[model samples]
Target: MSGTSEGPTPATDLIQPNVTHSDATPCPGTEQIAVPAAGQTAAAAPSAPSRGGPDAPLPATGGTTPMAESAPAPAGFTGMDQQPSAAPRRPPAEPPFRSAFSAAPLAMAVVDRDGLVVSANDTFGALFGGGPEEFTGQVAADLVDLTSDPRIRQAYQQVLDGRRARLRCARRLKHPDGHPLWVQITVAPLAPESPNVLLSVADISARRELQDRLRHVQNHDPVTRLPNRTLFFERLSAALEAESYESGGSGRVGLCYLDLDGFKAVNDTLGHRVGDRLLAAVADRLTRCANEAGHGRTSVPLVARLGGDEFALLVEGSTGTEQLAELAESVLTALQAPFEISGRQLSVSASIGVVERQAAGTSATALMQAADTTLYWAKADGKARWTLFDPERNAHRMTRQALVSSLRTAVDRGEFTLEYQPLVGMDDGRLRGVEALVRWRHPRFGTLTPNRFIALAEEDGSIVPLGRWILATACRQARRWQLDHPDEPPIFVSVNVAVRQVWDSDLVADVAGVLAETGLAPHLLQLELTESAVMGSAGRPLQSLRALSDMGVRIAIDDFGTGYSNLAYLSRLPVSALKLDGSFVRGFQHEENTGENAAGQGEEHDGAAGRPSPADEVIVEAMVQLAHRLGLTVTAECVETCDQASRLRRIGCDTGQGWLYSRPVPPDRISELLGSRC
Candidate 1:
């Protein structure tokens, strides 16, 4: 649309070219962009981004041109006037300063001392939905849509007043779409001698979202979306402060640390995928319980995912250990049911460790240390239980942890030694056999018992090596005893086998090798199996026991009566001898009773109902006769007293072993006992 030129024409019409293009050429609003007035050329100013408006005139970049490497000022306006008068000025070829400023990358603006946007860049113009001229005399707060939060005006004013150099702030800017674009606004003095403040803004919407994700990962567990260790520690420390340091505060903080029991079995039997899913389900249930406990199912505690199958709960304002126990019970009850995952009904159990403290000594580190100790105790007591922290028990737990840490290298260091308790024959009173028991001369802990380390050895799979050493050492000693006492009968060596030792390695071969290496006959091995263990045999223990027994190994059921009540089932096993549990022998006495008190009216059965009454010579005699008929030699255990030894010998019992004979004297001690007696 063309119009005849008026004498004093409008400034925009002077640069608005009327040249038309064919369909092949770049169309209007595309490549043929309108230019600015002569005064508008090179009039770009640093933008007041925080103020949100266009500025006029970029401060000259030194004396050098902006395009020059490392230079500042644009090439001294050289090419501007070089255009010929007859060159038919087509908007100066490149875009005018006004149009370029309207599309500048940064939301830049120039604001006066009155806090009004005099001019701004294209990005600033787009940000405020106003032209540079229209933005003149407009206050930054007015241009930024600060109607919701006008306090943003003060943030920019501080920069202008020299109280702040660069004001960094966040605000919601009204976008062209009528929505808010979160922008990180940066406002500062534009030029050294200039009266305006330059505001710079960045659309930080995406960066803010990224920051939120990073914060989530930092503060919460990736698997459970619950507060993680770091965040939990922070919250716990705060809770403790509230309980102890806060004014008028008298409550305590309770912590529960739970680890899923048998979870590794699930992970190995099922896959890790199922294990992860099970963990998630566990987290959900735990979160629910933590919310309910003291807070009555409405208040949520600081539930944290402390990595792996472990989770922790922080209960603030807890009163005492009773509350701690209740929290632990809640956790145990919550995990008592089955979790269905990966198409399997997985029953998982957790060991909870509860620690509560009213004072400020409850540091995050201290609480975690105590909780961890308690958790271990719970697991040790048997899975699916909770253990409260006790200072005394913590000492033992710490000692055990120290021992476990050092146990791996204990064997190589020769810290372990075997002591043999000779299994003496009841009839002949001769050293017929020896049971090997291991002891640890721990460097610091000193003389550790089997109860202290054998379980640890089993856990770390060190039992395989340690057990092998035990067998070989015991066999070698047995062979030495036989050689040393050539005139004496061959003494058998009984060694207890760990289930882990049997399952993880070739136990039969290891046993055979130990016997062969020590030159001890297989029958002289007497590998004892408990009733529970012998009966618990499946494919491996069964095959292994059978193979060894086929090779002349006399299998004896050790610790017999202590395990199972069923004596009839023993006949089905290959057990040749029954090692009567020592507990049964503790009752042996001189006086004998046939249960008839004067009249034998089935006299009200005193405590002794099943077995013969106290001092029952007849009951002892009957047990021996029954065992002999079954071809099962009865070995009476723990003949601790002379009366006991004499009484057992008179009762027709086959053999016995206990402190009464010698109190499990070592080899040299055995040599001493043997030289003094039969």
Candidate 2:
């Protein structure tokens, strides 16, 4: 018999009594180990030698040792304990697996093939709020709370079937104390041939909470806790994409861009802190409105703050523009109520620009741009209102912008040219003067009249330079015509002056310079200002007009009677003529049957019912008398027929300018007419 060490080995003490070791008969040179059957006591086995130590041969059968004499009678002994002479006497001590398992920080459990927890570590018991004994015999799925997830069961089956070596997942576990535990779970086979699996769990609730916070911060605004512009755009893009796919190009999407009117007053009077609180309150109301708008519907509108006082709402799968209009009206109405901020009630209104369109061809950028433009329209049309996007109006604006952008270079490029409209004498039927009309021969759009781009030019202050160019060009042409026709009576050239040009530029100096450069007498160059513009002139503007008149420049009030006629001031002005507005001249075409022929060859009517109505004739006669009293000439404009000319001549009109004699023609045409008249 071989002697075994009497000292208790660390590996032997760690092994529980329930754990069984395999029993195998020893060969000639090998040692064999046996485990006791259930309820049976067995003799102690020999302890293994220390690892990496000198080897000692096992004792052979019948070899005497210190413990051989004390060996109990072997019961059901399959083989005698022996040691080989050539082999090592003892094996190295087994590793401290039991101690490591018991001391591990991770919650660990051994589960059988039947999904039962065979054993659990103290950490596992503490994590689940119980002792190891309580966890033992419990179903592994029940303890881990993974039975609800089918993937976990599949993963376990795959690992157990030798398909995968290990499986990992995060799961929520139920604690005995009713608290929830988020844990990362890893499963692996205990051994190659064993029907048991080892599960390692780590509590990760803090990590999950941190991730959730990060996601929330990324998707929500810190101030309002609402979705910010970033998230709003993302959702808008997604909605557009989904609509494109689902509707196959017919689905509609709408956006309402809101800007608080008088929000700046709040910030200026109060402070930014109060403004921030007010914005928060506004956001709350907007969110509630959005929810109410989307209540009982499948799709909910997304409302977001685009920064500052600008907020936008996106409506996906919108039915039509009517729906968007309703939403916009609701937004404006909702903001009508006063907001209470820091014990102060503040009132605010919003301008909403609504744009609804098919989602197929529309892009996020285009939609946003349109919405912004519509918002501008709302503000421009008057705040506290909503404006629907109109393509025609937008095109007009875009064309205006294009014209403005091209105006600066149009002068240098010679895109502008002058057309001359002969101003004929109403009585003599001969050309007296010509009005210089500026025309823009655009590269893209052809033959644009002044009405198309003049307002745009005036707004951007580009009219100053353009007006200078027109003045210089028209004077040069008139001077040439005068030089060419020295024997003929001098024909004055009338040029229209814009209000901004008169107010913003040095009109006296520009006219003086142009007249000197072109060698045209100021008397032959007439500057026509609209009645409204001239009537409103005062201070420096009135002084400038008087100065120009003193310089031998002919100052005429175009479109007379269309504005407030300050006849008292008009009498004092150095105005050369009053060009009656076309509206007044059109009255001459209305022939009443008081037995008057087209040639006015009937009963002589003085301010009576005739081709020119009695009232209109009276007004014209009175205006002509007033002008004659002031020593100013009267010119009737928009004369298209001989009857109108006859009536104007009968009314003592000195000049007639319209298509009847000839439409506005070029300088050469005027020179021809002048030569003919001469």
Candidate 3:
């Protein structure tokens, strides 16, 4: 029995009823003793001499005492009235904790304040392949391998010194049979005031194995067995962080993002299954390329499949652009080879965008964005090539993006104005008609000419609204000129049209509406288009051109000789005039002189500087004659000198529009010219 004497013992603290004590009887005239609580000092029995006599009643303790019932004495003893000898009774049976500690199912041991093992249960002994008695005098930290780790050793010491309530950690241990075991160890004080601690160890190998398997499956791509996008971004973030914080590294990172060119065609022509096999093969080649690039390096590059046909190779601590470029080239060469799949040999090319830079100020999202844009450049430059990122080019692209985002809004805000370049009669030097040029009055960037943004407009289909605006404004200005200079003949206004305008909008309807709205006659308005747009015109474009021509609107081809200069199609199409490109006119800036004439009269012929070369003269003459034969007039552009104009007139050119007459001027200037002509 072990319990407190200060109060009646609780039933739970008493010795188990099942643990029977044998061959014992209470001494007569003595009170039954009470057990002390665990970890509490037990009261000593009254001394033999202190008791007045054997039959004398024991002195009363401060707390209530248990009384014994009268009963017959044991066979060898006298009746209940007999006095018992004062010799010290046999020491009370060993405390109950000993039994409980021995019978516990958990592997546990008791460690004294000095970190020595006081005792160990059978279960604890089996953990290290020894008997409980063998572990008793051993150092507890050494037995559990805690001494190897300084942090764990310190924590274990804290528990033994009673400074910490408990300590728990995990360890990888080797079993006596040579197999490895994963275990969780815990140490706690045996009692609130006791220096001894209880240490427990639990096996956790199965849980750890399951967790490892799940992590592998989560971070890898099933199709390629390569790290997936999640893991790829994770590693990239880590590399960037390390480059930013850690010392003594290259401080640069790089990536090669690529995809199989025309892979969709393969999937469409064949099947997805074949496409998948082709992608797998491509991944394998890319992996080998990465490994080859990593030779002699500290860390191998990571290859990841970022969904679909896209893949990326990440290199940490990259040396420079040269290293990344070498990797890209190797990838290109590897993918160029044909693959044999499903009894068919398929050939495919790859477009790779390589980006490498100092990792100091870059982020994962920004790096990926740069790589994607570079890949687009590679495709645009032509497939089967690798392109490195250029900051200047990216800046241009960013500016273009800004312009794109604001284009339609610019139109709605009326951020455009029209300028008219004079189209003068080659012989009379009189204004015949004016070509309408569009200018963007950008808020941030001062007035930009057509060359700066027209292509962008067409590509994005914003030219429809922009072209419509130009047409209406030019026609309105021409009508105003007609009213202001009544004495002069009304000159037609020629407006430039884009191919996209015909396909994206109803050109015929737009023209009719503008004419009707501005009260300008169709014959007084002309539409000028580049040769490339007008050549091989058919479908909606051909119909639109014919409709405009039939409405008495003039159709002139601008930049004629630069494109399909097929004069035969001139007869079949509804073209009204030909505007000879400036390149041909530039060739006439100087005349070729015979050797003797040039030597004798070099100074005198300086005034004839703009004479045409023989070949140019012949070509212009032939084209002018051929156009005349087809009932089409001719306009020569870029006429910058008097001699050039005179030569064009001599060649029977009908109109001249260039710096020679007037640069593209504002509507008010055209009004002044019209009034002056009147």
Candidate 4:
């Protein structure tokens, strides 16, 4: 009944329809009116309004009318105000409800009680990657991909049946184009008497990704962008049990453990930010290298970060130790390049220790132990290189392990012993003092050297206690020797101090107490330290060393050339002597073609292996000369023959200590050496 008018002059030819009114009256509240010619049917209504003109014709009904069919004023209409009669007006049109869904922002779908899609908003259509027309007649199940939980269907049915006020679930939706979107959907029943149910979906993809990102950060190191310990152990455990390796014959696992050399200097000199960037850059380079170096070979390396300045590669299914060695060499080569970080071109170097063994019967602890021990050797053997695990080295390690396992009880059991290596005066060959080295007489593994177990003690933090026992035992021996040779000059005792002893216990008090307990004069005692151990001695280190030195106790730099030696720093130190590293003296001696080592510069460092540069004997000689010039006594270490010791004595070296004098003999032998019996 609502439409526009068209022109029709004929009155008799008008058609009849649902909305027909022959008489034209003033519109009740509206100012418009429609009239048809007299005797005309609704369909034959005049096209134009007569406007009270008798000559006007009525509109015809193929929907043509002057008043737009005039709609019917109203069924109950009466003349306005009773006294002044006027026609009532038709009602105004209201917009359709379903049409508004076209522009809705949120994805929406209209479903019947039977769960069929009665309609869909553009957004809903887009959510399924289709148009409204494509979804209109589709079943609700058609829009929900296969990933939807079957349980969700029951929930959806509950929503449609009004058993639940709303059905909500978080699910990953599959798009028509195959990309997935995480979504939170709420399905609710529509209005009463409406056959439809409403589904409102929100794309929660970004939020889901945020959660995943948080999880990733939780397992990876921010500095290196490598999997940290948490993730490393996680993957290791998985590998231990995973079926992926089950398909092939079981192969042994190998590990390449590495530590950075001079990385701390870079961190201390440059800011940590630069260090972090450097670590990230290194991580990237190493990962690429590990993968490229026969990645899928017998042992493929899984590189991971293990805290600061440490990294590891897990070689799963390594064919043998050789494969791991190849991997290690590749890694070393990969890191040989200069790294540009924070706009600084810094040369970074690393030392790596390789331990390869069958994962069979090997616990993570065992593997880590072997790797760690080898790592120490790599560093001790000199930095910027790699070393493979040797069973011979491992046998030595097992002995040390036994010692460490027994160390905590050795003091209580009296299994700990000390053998003194005499520090002789190079000029006079007089005993300066005996550098006391501890040994262990294990019930199972015989006498053990200090090098065999000292580091383990240090690692387990047992050095503090073990070192105390060594000090006490050596002091007690010194006291006995003094009493035995009272008429002769009193000999001093030199004790090695473990770095841990300095940090964990009161070294000053410990040393003072030991001397007092033994009734030995302070001047008769000396403490030996490796170069690095004393390089940047802690404030406590300085205090302890000075406290002992002030009491007339001597302090000496042990293995001087092997560590980060800063001659300037040593000048300000309270040290009384410098023990040249063994490498220096040993390398300086050469045998001629008569099957003797030619002592020129000595063989290049690993020159046999083409690694670090050759050991420079001239440099060692220069160091000995320089130390004596500084009023510091020079002790030549590892002098294997009298000739080498003689050369050292000629070089003005203040002392000589090594195999030539006797391989660290027991205190009884020292008594002979000092008592003029040797």
Candidate 4 residue-wise lDDT, 196-262, digit = tens: 6777778889999999899799988888778898888777666555423576745477789999898
Best-to-worst ranking by lDDT: 3, 2, 4, 1
**In terms of TM-score, how similar is model 1 to the real structure?**
0.59
Residue 39 lDDT in model 4?
42
> Model 2 clash tally?
5
Off by over 4 Å in 4: 1-405, 590-617
lDDT of 2 by residue, 276-393 (tens): 9989999998988888889886677899988889999999998899888888888888988899899999999999999999888989999999999999999999999999999999
Clashes of each: 28, 5, 4, 28
Residue-level error in angstroms, candidate 3, position 135: 8.2
lDDT of 4: 0.73
Candidate 3 has its poorest 10 consecutive residues by lDDT at 1-10
Best by TM-score: 3
Ranking by TM-score: 3, 2, 1, 4
lDDT of 3 by residue, 316-380 (tens): 99999999999999998898788999999999888999999989999999999999999999999
